[model samples]
Target: MKHLLTLSISIFFITLFPSYSQDQSDNDFKEEVKRIEQLTIKSIKLRQQINPEAEQEALNDEIKTLDATLLKKVTLFLNEYGWKSKKEIGELANMGLFLAIQHSSTEEMESFKDIIERAYEADKIEENSYALYIDRLKVRNDLPQIFGTQYYFDEKSASLRFNEIEDFKNVNKRRKKVGLAKIEKYAKQNNIALD
Candidate 1:
């Protein structure tokens, strides 16, 4: 009877302590973010390997499943912690969160606009990723893209082209302000044609 009582007490303590200390939970979050970043890389590579043209429905379905899994995990984390800065969570974990949000639905991405802006202002996110995210959201809302980071498929030429932007005359100035190269140089490097 004493042994049974001692075993019960031990089990109670096991459940009560050390299973999720603050440090342990933080480490778990960091590791999960790292795993998520790696998974995003694999998802992108899988698409490239399976079908760059995106004609394969099977490949599309696989990508969607992977994206959904990532989105769900990221959303849960975001709900629990809001937005974490790079200093708070480290660069690798930040990258993982960035990629997960980028791969998420447009609405889901928009929902985090304030957090993105905060992260950007705090220099917690990369300039390139920040520009891309902002450009996408702006274009979605019928506003002119400021950074020209978003691209679209030109059906007429069957080529990828930068989406239309506001004030093309000074697009480079805006991009340069954000530490991006001039649009022409960027276009040349990416093999995109300028209209």
Candidate 2:
């Protein structure tokens, strides 16, 4: 009788534990997502404050520190859960991934490119974000950007300018297809004046 009772309890726990762990994992994943979102926003705002002047050196240092911490967490999360585990989590992961791109070495960016492509093919991330990643990678390689997602403030020209585009004439068509705003509007919104 005792043996029977023990066996039943064992079976009950065996069945319950997997579900319990899964629920825990889900919660943990969401918490990480929230962290990533907050960190990414903070990093972007800090980056905007950075300039050539030494006045913002402290802010730039903070941005670097945040980027390093964010990259470590993101690398661990990607190693554990990979790129296809959850839709919402994948979207949040993109925020971390973009920040990682800003600070990664060349080889690291290459590896990230593979992960981003895989995520895009799996439909885990949206097209717009996917394009941004690819375009950033292209810019790093000194290749023309396909999606026009990367831009810089040209202080000399007093305009916001996109990275080198593969084809200037059809860039807007490609941008629109990926749900990106028209280039002129994008430039204006980003405080870049068009010539």
Candidate 3:
């Protein structure tokens, strides 16, 4: 009788715990659905009037809405298409239908690209390379802030630069660097180049 009771409890717990985990996953999926819906509505309303800067703004909002997992998906999709930076998404967006087709597998990305392309072609709008710029901003956020403003890898110089200042001295010298080694590790894991 004890053995039977123990078996029943174990089976019940195993079944119940898995269901709870599935429920959490479902909840996350639902939230993603809601976010996508909101973006879709915004895209539709802004479509005719959208500028490249405005479109970039929308992209930033979408990026913020994405969880880290979804960001990885976006990054993977970008890499799959051989994109290097945010500028690529913008350029592809300008290329019109081909870009849409290329990202057809990503529903929101496809839709957003279409809208941006249509707006750019219609309005002849040109904005700063916010997409490429945003990628740099994201990278900066991932690193220590002490790296200071405009810090970027000067691949040509083979040194990290803070602002226009190439020389890192004193505290600037202590700014932790993200070298090719780190980028390579990330690239290997994501099957994408860091550039």
Kindly list the per-residue Cα lDDT of model 2 for residues 24-125, writing each as its tens digit: 999997787777778877877777776642466677678778888888877877887776434556554566656666476667778777778787788776
Q: Between which residue pairs do clashes occur in model 3? A: 86-131
- By TM-score, the best candidate is 1
> How well does candidate 1 match the true structure in TM-score terms?
0.79
User: Each model's TM-score, in the order given?
Assistant: 0.79, 0.79, 0.28
As for candidate 1, its clashing pairs are none
Tens digit of per-residue lDDT, candidate 1, span 33-152: 676667767766866766333568877788888888877877787777766777786766677678778877779898888888887888878888898888888887778899988776
Compare candidates 2 and 3 on lDDT and give the better one: 2
* Candidate 3 error regions (>4 Å): 51-195
Model-by-model lDDT, in order? 0.79, 0.76, 0.40
Report the candidate with higher lDDT, 1 versus 3.
1
Which sections of candidate 1 miss by over 4 Å? 1-20, 50-54, 87-90
What's the distance in Å from true for residue 46, model 1? 2.8
Off by over 4 Å in 2: 48-55, 84-87, 90-94, 153-160, 193-195
Per-residue lDDT tens digits for candidate 3, residues 47-143, read: 4453432337765554344333333443444344332222433433333222222223344443445444553444432332223222334343453
